[model samples]
Target: MSLGAAPAPGVLEERYARLPAHQREKLNRIADTRRRLDAAARGAYEALREAQDDLRRARAALREAEEHTTRRTGGTLSLRQPDGRVMEFPARPWPPPELAQRVQRLEADVARLHAEHAAASAPAGVTTRLYERLLEHLGLRDLA
Candidate 1:
């Protein structure tokens, strides 16, 4: 067990297992927190992908609905607002506000999750390498 040499496989884990119970518990908690955070980041990415897909589907449906409405209404579309106002468009009618807002909300959600996911993902192995360096500097690597 040199001061800074890499421990053989299982040697480090053996040493870790020999640590005091409280210290082992703390290390386990730290590892668990990392796993949970990683899982949450993955979930956010999945949700972001789902939101993007929903936005695309919503836009496509809106286009299709608009075309259908135009054909059925002879280029005039009338929509009733929540405030009890009837609004009519003559040609290439605008989408109902609710429908438009649904797409907007999904787009916004995707954007937010994308930013969060990017922020959550640190460069891989950086923290692990840093911890290894710290342990070596402290001469703790000899514990193996």
Candidate 2:
């Protein structure tokens, strides 16, 4: 739309065009807020990824320590961890209910937040269905 031409019926674009000093300042503030929100969300997601990587490293360390203890001691891997807590590997593999529950909750939270972020980042007039489809691949749904 041209600056001189009238915008859609109740858009207030005409007024926005006229009040350069006031409206321009307001628009600038809005734009700055939007930019900051985007940056903050991006930072949050990056931090989350880093934390996930760290968690993976910790799990890898635990597994490696178990294997090393098993091979070196020629006995079942039962020893005190760095925190002075003894850990015993189960002989038969079994699902840990507590761990499973925590994992499920975290996955759900991540999915919800991801969906919300994607939706928020989308431009005005974008369809919610389209936004949701984008979230589907991330195993997410729109959230508050």
Candidate 3:
């Protein structure tokens, strides 16, 4: 660890090398952590997408319902939720209970995506493929 001597070959690579008895162990641990996170991110992203799709479909259905009601009732669509909140649609942004709940969930998911995307910047471009490769090298790819 002296500073006066010239650095040896593979010095930089050796810096990441594990101890004699712990060869590849630290790297293995890091890869495992990254893999877990990658799996969690994939799950979260999938859930977000599903929730978003659900929200879209719900909103579209509500719109059609409102249009149909307005046309039939002359701009008066009475929708009674299970909680007994009967309100006239085409008047406020909040239409159906399902749409409202899904929108809220979607908004939360967007916030999570923003946070995770910000926190997930890998200098080596840790993409899904890269993540899988790392797992493969660690002999844990099959678990993923």
Candidate 4:
């Protein structure tokens, strides 16, 4: 059957009805297994997406905090030279204690998010591997 265009509405049903009873039963079992595997894959993908969103949020928060700190402390410095000339320099101060602590917390949050993302991705990888093995066993390795 061509995949580019779907079969007519009842074509699948008619084909299945023409099959022998034993083959129909086996096809039903395979369909059920495929449904379960698809659900598992979708769940794993959702988990990975959530983890990625969390990581993005944490990184955004860290960037905002750092920008705020920089804005507050990144001022210009000026000095009067002994020859009555004025010299100007940029003054970018180190992060204040509070800002430092906040940064440290955000860094930890990012690390945790990274770990969560990895954990969530592992299940999806395992599902793909299992599905590939199943296809190979069924002599459908081309599908894999």
Local accuracy of candidate 2 as per-residue lDDT tens digits, 1-144: 123554457445444455547545745554556566677568667755655565566556556545434222333346466666766663422223554455555556566666656655563224334434433433322220
lDDT of 3 by residue, 9-56 (tens): 665345444334353574456567676766766766676677667667
Q: What's each prediction's TM-score?
A: 0.58, 0.40, 0.46, 0.44
Q: Candidate 1, clashing residue pairs?
A: none
Question: What overall lDDT goes with each candidate model?
Answer: 0.67, 0.50, 0.57, 0.57
Which structure among the candidates has the greatest lDDT?
1
Q: Per-residue lDDT of 4-113 in model 4, one digit per residue for the tens?
A: 55655776566557767876576556656666656655666666566666656765765664544322333664545556565555754444465566556666755666
State residue 96's C-alpha deviation in candidate 1, in Å. 3.0
> RMSD of each candidate?
8.3, 12.6, 11.8, 9.2
| Of candidates 4 and 1, the better by TM-score | 1
TM-score of 1: 0.58
Give the TM-score comparing model 3 with the true structure, all chains together: 0.46
Best by TM-score: 1
Ten-residue region with minimum lDDT total, candidate 2: 135-144
Name the TM-score of candidate 2: 0.40
For candidate 3, which ten residues in a row score worst on lDDT?
Answer: 12-21
